[model samples]
Target: MQILITGGTGLIGKQLCKALLAEGHELTVFSRNPASVPAKCGAGVHAIGALGEWHPGKTFDAVINLAGEPIVDARWTARRKQVLWDSRVTLTKELVRHIATAGRKPAVLISGSAVGYYGNRGDTAMYEAADAGEDFAAQLCKAWEDAAHAAEQVGVRVCLLRTGLILSNKGGLLGRMLPAFKLGLGARLGNGKQWMSWVHIDDYVAMVLKLLHDSFASGDQASLALASGPYNMTAPQPATNAEFTAALAKALHRPALFAAPAPLLRLAMGERAGLILEGQKVLPGKMTAAGYRFQYPNLDDALGNLFGR
Candidate 1:
């Protein structure tokens, strides 16, 4: 299989590429800066600029789109919101247009979405069947998935991977939280009751490969791939914020410090604070029922695997 990934230099993309290559699959990393891709990726790499600038000459077996701006890195000013919106929604829309009109459409397009599509649902458990929230994050995912679905018109299969908070030492939330945990300054935010859905970086990549292979077995219908627009790419079990905090601290052999008040987080992070302070109890009902198995289904096991005790 030939898998082409956008944002290959990113944490998830890098690991995904490595795993695919180990499995004897060919790879191409879509990049704005071809030089940004590491030398170690070897001969499988093929750079075609950014998502918006990609030219559709060579059709791939699969195209995994992970191109997007980090949402939590900056304060959510109007400018930041626009950047987030354009990077995911707008860029996805352009890529779909390119694929839909291409001379040779790929077998499958595995585009990245997020559990943020559910919004801040408090303690409510969310499945892919649940209605999407109307906030910025939810709306962003909604638009992004809608755009990716346009590829169905061109006889191309599309899988919307509504990814969760990725648990990796390489980057994402864990990368930011590791230092504080090492210093014993880590604890839950607010009441620590919000449901937090997460996925191991290993299984996350495995699922992408699974979906890519699934599309190969699927034929006779392009829209069949878009049959499930928002598959919850999370573990079977959802943990609370407090559970994650306690497990992380225990694994690191550090004392859990004082809780960061929600008010303080809001003051410091503005609207973006909701990402950490509030969460939806997302379940991977669709993915599991679709024949996918989680490598790390529980928080303690996931934490131990990533930050070994």
Candidate 2:
């Protein structure tokens, strides 16, 4: 299959591209810098600086939309918020427009979203059927998914990946925490009770491959039902902040003796701190029901794998 991926330079995107290429799929990565794309994405992947760079009549078998600004990088000032919205919502609109005009429409569009679509629901287990919250994250995900869903009208199967915290050794939430925790400065946030829905990078990539495979096999009437709607790309078990901290510290052979108070966090990060202090216990209902097995379903196993413990 020929797959076109936006944001193919990102942490998850790079790994996904390599995996797809290894499986004998042709890859075209849409990148901001075409020159750097080869270095960033490695060989066997074509890179385009702009959508217009593609030939007018060219089309992909599938489109994976993962282009977006890093959500928790900085304070969510008005400008920062706008950047986030434009990167996700605006980029998605453009991708859909490309799909609409393509000579051969892609069979599937796997768009990225977040479990934050459920907002800070505390302990309430989130599922695809649950209503989204009214918060900014929720609103952002809703718009992102809605934009991608537009392709369904073109007879394209659309799947929204409501991703959670992605755990990887190279870079992501866990990477940033390693240096501090190695020095025994590991700490929990806001009493460490908030639920954290996270996934190992391996499982994340596997789920995506599964979805793409389903799309490839779904050309017939019976198989067409295999890929549709939102699929939560998280581990089966959702870990709390405290549990995550404990497991990471154990894996690192470090002491988790510090706690960042909620007040301090809020003062430092402003509204962005809510992401750490408040979280939802999201479940991968759709993925599980569809028979997708997670490579790392628990915090302990995931941390152990990452830390080589």
Candidate 3:
């Protein structure tokens, strides 16, 4: 299959591209720094500086949309919020427009979303069918998904990946917390009771590959049935922030003995702090029912795999 991917140099995109490349699938990556794509994503990846490069004559079997600003990297000032919105929603809208005009439309569009779509639901279990939250992050994800859903009208299968916290040896939520955990400065945030839906990077890549290949490539009725719509890209067993902290500390042979108060986090991060202080217990209800198996369902197992313990 020939694939075009946005954010192909990102954490998840890098790994996903490697997997696709290993399977002998041709990949074209859209990047701000087109020259760096071959170095960052891998050799043999054709890089495009703009979506316009994909002329109407150009064709792709599949399109993976993962471009977005790092939501937690900076404070959510008014400007920063707009940047987030434009990067995801605006880009997706443009991608769909291009898809509509394509001489040969892709069979499927695997677009990115986040578990933040559920907002601060506390212990309430969220599934793919759950309603959108009213918070900024949730609204952002809803609009982003809505933009991607436009491809369906053109007869393209659309899959929205409502991803959770991804655990990997490289950068992500785990990368940001590893330094502190390794030094035994690990602490739970806000009382540590907020539920966290997470997935190991390996499982994340595998699930995506399944959707790309099985859902559209193969003519399996079950696969086609599960091909479109939202999927909670999360592990089966959700954990609390406290449980995640303890598991990481245990995997690193360190002690966790402190807490980051919610007030301090709010003062430091402002509205962005809600991302940490509040979370949803999202489950991969659709994925599981679709017959996808999880490689790392437990928090301890996922951390152990990452730490090689």
Candidate of highest TM-score? 3
Extract clashing residue pairs from model 2. Answer: none
Predicted structure with the largest lDDT when compared to the true one: 3
Candidate 2 local Cα displacement, residue 14, angstroms: 1.0
Better of 1 and 3 by lDDT: 3
How do all the candidates rank in terms of lDDT, highest first? Answer: 3, 2, 1
Q: TM-scores across all candidates?
A: 0.93, 0.97, 0.99
Model 1 clashing residue pairs (backbone): none
Ranking by TM-score: 3, 2, 1
lDDT value for candidate 2? Answer: 0.89
Stretches off by above 4 angstroms in model 1 are 40-43, 51-56, 218-228
TM-score of 1: 0.93
- Alpha-carbon error at 89 in model 1, in Å? 1.1
Clashes of each: 0, 0, 0
Stretches off by above 4 angstroms in model 3 are 217-219
Q: What are the lDDT scores of the predictions, listed in order?
A: 0.82, 0.89, 0.94
* Candidate 2 deviation (Cα RMSD): 1.1
Report the lDDT tens digits of candidate 1 across residue range 19-127. 8888898787877678766563556476666554545676677778888899889998999999998888888888777777666778788898899988999878898
